[model samples]
Target: MGRIPGRLPFFLETFAQSSIKSHGSRIHPERFNSTSNKVPDMKAHQTREVIFSGIQPTGVPHIGNYVGALQNWIRLQELKKEGKKEMDLYYSIVGLHAITLPRDPLQLKKERFEMMCVLLAIGLDPAHCCLFNQDQVPAHSEMAWILNCIAPVGRLNRMTTWKSQIASSKNSNSLSEVDDSMLHLGLLAYPVLQSADILLYKSTQVPVGEDQIQHLELTKVLAKALNKQTKNKNLFPLPQGIYTRQSKILNLRNPTMKMSKSNPSDLTKILITDTPEEIRKKIKSAVTDSIESIRYDPENRPGISNLIDIYQSISGQELEQVQRRFQDKSVVDLKSELIELLIEHFRPFNAEFSRLVNSREDVEKIYLAGSQKAAAVANLTLSQVKKHIGLD
Candidate 1:
C-alpha cells in the first residue's frame, strides 16, 4: 500500500504535444524511423505522476474496502499535501463499468450519488484531486472503442475476472467449463475499457487490489501495443501498479471469500456509515474459531486472522503488535475492542456522509466540477490519440 517516496520528473505538456505531431501520418509513417519508437525502448518519459483509481457504484463500501484501498488513497492525498510527491490524482464512480453486470436503473442512479458522497466523506479533497463520475465523461467510452480496435481478442479471452465470474456462476473452478457464449461483449471487453480509464488521463500509476493486477497489466500491454502500432512512444504512459499489503480483505462470516457487497449477508462486512450499535452487533456476531484464543494464524483460523487484520488496519499497528496487545484475550473481548475502534474512527465520517446525503444538490456540483477537471485531461489525451490515428 505504501510506496517509497521519490520525485519523478514533471511531464511537460509541450513535449507530449510536439512528440505526437512528429509521428503524425502527415510526415509519412516510413519517416517515423527512430530507436526510441521501438517497443522495448518505450520508457516512461513523463515524470508527472497521474494516479487514477475507480470504485463501482454497486453498494456502500465496507470497512475492508476502506482499509485496503481508500485508506491508501488518503495517504497519497496527505503525501500530496506535504509536497513530498507531485502527482495528479483522479478518482471516479465507475458507473459505466458497473452496467457490465446486471443492475436496476433506479438503484444504479442512487448508488452513483452515494458512492460520490462516500468519497467525500472519506476525506478525498475535490480541490486536490479530480473526483467524478465515469458516465459524465464521454472520452472514456470513445477511447475504449478506439483501443478495442487494437486490443487483441485472444488477450481479452485470457482475462481472469470475467472467466472467474462465469466459473463461480457455474460452480466450477476450471475455465474450460466456460466459453465465449456465456459472457456478454461488455463483460468480455471490460479490460479494454479499464485500459481506457487509465490511459484517458495518462495515468502513470493505478491504485488497485491484487485481483485487479491483471487489468492494470492489460492497460500496460495496450499502452505498449499502441506505442508500437503508432510508432509514438509518448502517446500514453504504461501505468504501474500500486499494490497494497491488505488488498484482499476477507469476509467476516466466511473468511474463505472476499468481503463483497454481493455477499447477501450484511454481517459479512461493516459499512462506513454503520452505527455504533450495528458495528457492535456485527463484530459480536463475527464468525470466530471455537478454540477461543486470539492468534494470527490465517490458514487454520481465517476468521480470527481476519478480525486481527481489521483491528491492525484500524489501529495502524503491526500484527505482532496487535497480537502482543491481545495475547490472552478472548474473541468476545477482541470483538468489543474492534467495535470501539471502528465507532471512534467512523463517527465524524458518518456525520459527513449524512450531511452530503442530505445536500444532494451540493454533491451534484462537486461531481460536475470534478467531471469537468477530468474531462479537460481526457479531452487532450483523446484529441492527441485521434490525431495520431488520423481520426481527426
Candidate 2:
C-alpha cells in the first residue's frame, strides 16, 4: 500500500469515530472534518517509524550504558519535539530476560524499579515514550508462545548466545551445569521471546547494539516466517536495526570484557548511582599504559581508546577533535579531564535518581498505567495473529 498523507489525523479520526460509536453517541461530521483539516501539514512529518528498544533490569546502568544505548533514546525523544516524525517509542525494562541466569528475587524486583528510575533520569520522557516492565504486559508472553510453536528448534540450537553461556557454565563448577535437564525451555527459547517483544508491538525500527544484530535478524526471519505460515500479506512489517555509533564500553580493569553488571569487581563498572568521588576514583584507577603520549588506537591501547570513546560519546565531540584538543597532554591530564566531564554530566542524574527512589509509589503507578496503554495495542495485534493462524 502507498503511504497515507496526514496519517495521524486519519488515525485519530478513526479512533474518535470508533470510540463514539462504541459509546452509542451521535456522530458529529463537522467535528471530524475540522480536526482532519487542522493537520494537513502532518503529511510532511508522517513516517511510519515506530521504534522499540529494551534493557534488561539487572541493575543501575554505567557510563558506557548511557553512551551506547540511552543517549540514542534521548536523541529520538528530541526528534518528537522537533516534529520530525510521529513516533510511538516504546522502551521496555525486560525483567523477563534477566531471569535466564540465577537471580535473587528481592534484588531483582528492586533493580527493576531502579532501572525505570534510571531511564527517566537519562531523559526518556514518559509523555513521549512508553516505559514499563515486560512481564506486566501479558501480550508479550502470549505472542511469544504463538511464535515459539512456529520457530524451528534447529534455528534455536544455532543461536550462539545460549551455546556460549552453556560452554562457560560447563567450564565452571555451577550447579546449573551439572544438571543438563535444568536448562529450562525459557532459556533455550530466549530469542523467540525477544522476537515477540519486537514484533508484538509492530515496531518498525529497533536501536540495537553491535552484539544484538543477530537477534534483530532472527526477529526479521520469524516475522517473515509467521506471515508466510499464516498466508497473511504484510501482517508484520520487518523491523530495521538503527545502529548506534558508540563503541561498546569495556571494563575499567579488564579492558577486553564489556562493562557488565555481572562483573564481580565493583570498581570495574561505574554504576549510575555512583557518587562523584567514586566515579573520580574509578577513572583515576582505569587501566592505562606506562607510555607517555595519549592516542586513540584501540588495537594497541584499548584502555586509553575506551576512555576516549566514552568522552566522545558523552560530549558529542569527534575523535579527531578530541585528539586535537589533547595533542600535547599526558595520560594523567586526559584522565583528569574525563573525570571532571563525567562528574558534571552525572550530577543531575544522581539527584533525579534520589527523587525516583524515594517515590516508589508514584513509579509503580506509572508502570501500571503505561503497561495498560501498551497492552491495548499489543493485544489487538495478537488477536489478529490468532485469527490468521486459525486459533481464534
Give me candidate 2's TM-score against the actual structure.
0.84
Model 1 pairs in collision:
1-244, 9-47, 11-48
TM per candidate comes to: 0.86, 0.84
lDDT of 2: 0.73
Residue pairs that clash (backbone atoms under 3 angstroms), model 2: none
Ten contiguous residues with the weakest lDDT in model 1:
13-22
lDDT score of model 1?
Answer: 0.76
- Over 164-228, each residue of candidate 2 has an lDDT whose tens digit, in order, gives 45543343323334444556777889888999999977888888766577788889989999889
Instruction: Identify the runs in model 2 with alpha carbons over 4 angstroms from their true place.
Output: 1-47, 163-183
RMSD of 1: 11.6
lDDT of 1 by residue, 250-359 (tens): 87888887777766678878988799999988898888889987888888999988888888877777668999988998888888898998888787777778877888
Note the Cα lDDT for every prediction shown: 0.76, 0.73
Give residue 212's lDDT in candidate 2 (0 to 100).
Answer: 73
